[model samples]
Target chain A: MARAAVKAQAAEPLDGAERILQILSESARLFATTGYDGTSMRDIAEACGISKSLLYHHFKDKDEIYARITLGSTRELYQFVFDRLPEGARPIERIRGFMVATGEYFQRYRWAWVASTTAFWNDPEQRRQKERMMWRDRYENLLRGLIQAAIEAGELRPLDVPLAGRLILSSLNWMHRWYKPEKGMSAPQIADAYFDMILNGLKVEG
Target chain B: MARAAVKAQAAEPLDGAERILQILSESARLFATTGYDGTSMRDIAEACGISKSLLYHHFKDKDEIYARITLGSTRELYQFVFDRLPEGARPIERIRGFMVATGEYFQRYRWAWVASTTAFWNDPEQRRQKERMMWRDRYENLLRGLIQAAIEAGELRPLDVPLAGRLILSSLNWMHRWYKPEKGMSAPQIADAYFDMILNGLKVEG
Candidate 1:
């Protein structure tokens, strides 16, 4: 009988990986809307219309699901931008491309970005700590490299690369908090506005 | 007998104002850390070592408490900065004072600011909507006035004042998402950094 039960469980159409993804997505939305500590495992199961036992089978707990979702987001973001950085593109074009891609990502995956950022401070567990560090390092390195190249090529002003990188990223990242799709401006339009502001300033050139 | 009961209830050392403030402060912390829907009356009361009945006495319900806290924050912010804007001050100095005061508010009431912003999107109930609209109007008006004054004074190059105002507020608001008191930077330092970036670009002058 035990063997039969095991076989039935294994043969179920709901595989662990699929179940995990569903849980992560639901949890991400809830966390983004409600917050990490605010969401419960029961919330995820109900949102998914699955049994608690079935949900547990896919993942150990909530933190595990949160970590997975955040890691996936960070990975996807890094790959999306870094993979397309053409070797021979001018610094101006490169920076613009990066900003555009970032704006698009913010528009597309607004919830995930919100969840990751909101949870960063609240969860100081060791696992979360490591994840935050890893995510920050990846972005810092990529941005530093881009800014350094721009400065070397005389395509950009010589500024403190690290601070400049933080400012640029912070400006772009802030969009998720306020950008509404219902608004008339598309992501590309917003990106263009930001690009113009960063390249120049509010002052119209003489 | 009813009068006596009423008198007894009123006589309990529970200062309505003080009790309400305590509840608001606790709720802000929980909401900032957990999220609005994640916090409950029981949780809040427990955190304050009071019964849920006492909580309800001061607040009609959770939404009321949330609205009160948010509205209170906006009132405090407006009071802090508006009072400091001197009539004869240069446009740049006025802007700086605004930024510095805003940074101080965030530092002192970090949880309240975070809760207000995060809850604005997550909860769109009537009360939240009212609070959000009030905040939006205040911010828009303040920015519009600042930009006009700056332009009139020739401190800022002419551009879209409304848009510029939104962008400036957006950048400043994003600070709560990442600002940490323990991160080796005070509120003043962060405000200074932002002010410098806005006044001057990262590029060294040719």
Candidate 2:
């Protein structure tokens, strides 16, 4: 079998990480479509076109699947935003780049966003909820720190640091509700418009 | 037993609309605590300390109860914001008043805010979903019109009108996720800070 695998790489279409991501991505859609309680491991197994045993091998239970989705999505999202911004970019530019990458990813991973919106704070499994919130706080604090640096450097105006962080992120996060790729406002355009509001302030430059 | 024939004045505690509101508000909390799918009419009945028949008598089903919660909450929220503002107030004052009212209500009715965050777009009951979105659009348009008026009157900078509206409301709506009454920041204080950022511009006088 090892020799045959080496001879025909296409036989195992997806590598291990890719296979796991595919399972997670597919399960996220299901969890989004049906409430978390409404989705079962058998459902995920069927959706992934794998046997139930294989599904368990990948995920011990739905709670683990959900925890992975939440953590994975959060980590990937933070990495995508930070990595996409070129090092040494101005703080304001860094913000715009982060928003653009985030908007693009939100558009692409609509299901994951929806899945995260589910109420995990009150989850019966306390560990999963705590794990999710830990990552969330990390994301919030890092973003808030970037904004604070801009304020300190005089690149941005001083305001309530925590509120500013929430404001910027809320605007971007709400995109999943209304953004339509077919509607023709590209993600980059949205990033520009949002930055316009955030950096320029809504009151016409006095 | 049909009201005890004009018995004690305090015998029947709540009036018709008030009674319904009480039920909806309680159910909203349960829905927030437990996923919508996890909630049952029997559970709502139990939560309200009423018989299942009485609960059904008021709401034909959970869909009806949910629809009422969404619509009632939206209508009350809109009225709260608009009614709180005095006629002919300056755009800045009007905006601040509106924010304060909204923030107060979001904190007060935390459960309804959580309920609205749930993914109703793909709800199995399409009618309930559409009914909710219609009110949502009405709220959005009303808010957008107020912002446009501000821009036209030179109170606000000319930015993307719709985007500005979304940004402001999104920031307010997200309060449920993070705001806690015991967090030392009052709802009105949060509102003032938000209005400060939105109206005064975040950038130091450029």
| Winning model by DockQ | 2
Docking class of 2: acceptable
| Residue lDDT tens for model 2, B1-206 | 11122123224675765456556766787776686899998877765556788778788998888777866777766766677775798776777777788887676555666666655323566676676777677777877877888888898877678888878887787777677676567777887787777666666676
Candidate 1 ranges with C-alpha deviation above 4 Å: A1-68, A114-129, A152-160, A204-206, B1-67, B120-125, B152-154
What tens-digit string does per-residue lDDT give for candidate 2 at A1-206? Answer: 32232224323666665456556766788876686789998888776666799878878998888777876777666665667775798877777777787776676555666567655323566776677677777777877877887888898786778888888888787776677766667766786687778777778675
The deviation in Å at residue B31 for candidate 1 is: 7.6
Ten residues in sequence with the least summed lDDT for candidate 2 chain B: B1-10
lDDT value, residue B169 of candidate 1: 72
What C-alpha lDDT, on a 0 to 100 scale, does residue B92 get in candidate 1? 72
Compared with the true structure, what per-residue lDDT tens digits does model 1 show for residues B1-206? 32233234334565765456456767888876687899999988876668888888778788887777767667656766687666688887777777777877677656667766664435556775676668757856886788788888787787667656666676678777667676567665677676666655544343
Clashing pairs in 1: none
- In candidate 1 the C-alpha lDDT for residue A39 amounts to 90
Top TM-score prediction, candidate number: 2
Worst 10 residues of 1 chain B by lDDT: B1-10
TM-score of each: 0.65, 0.74
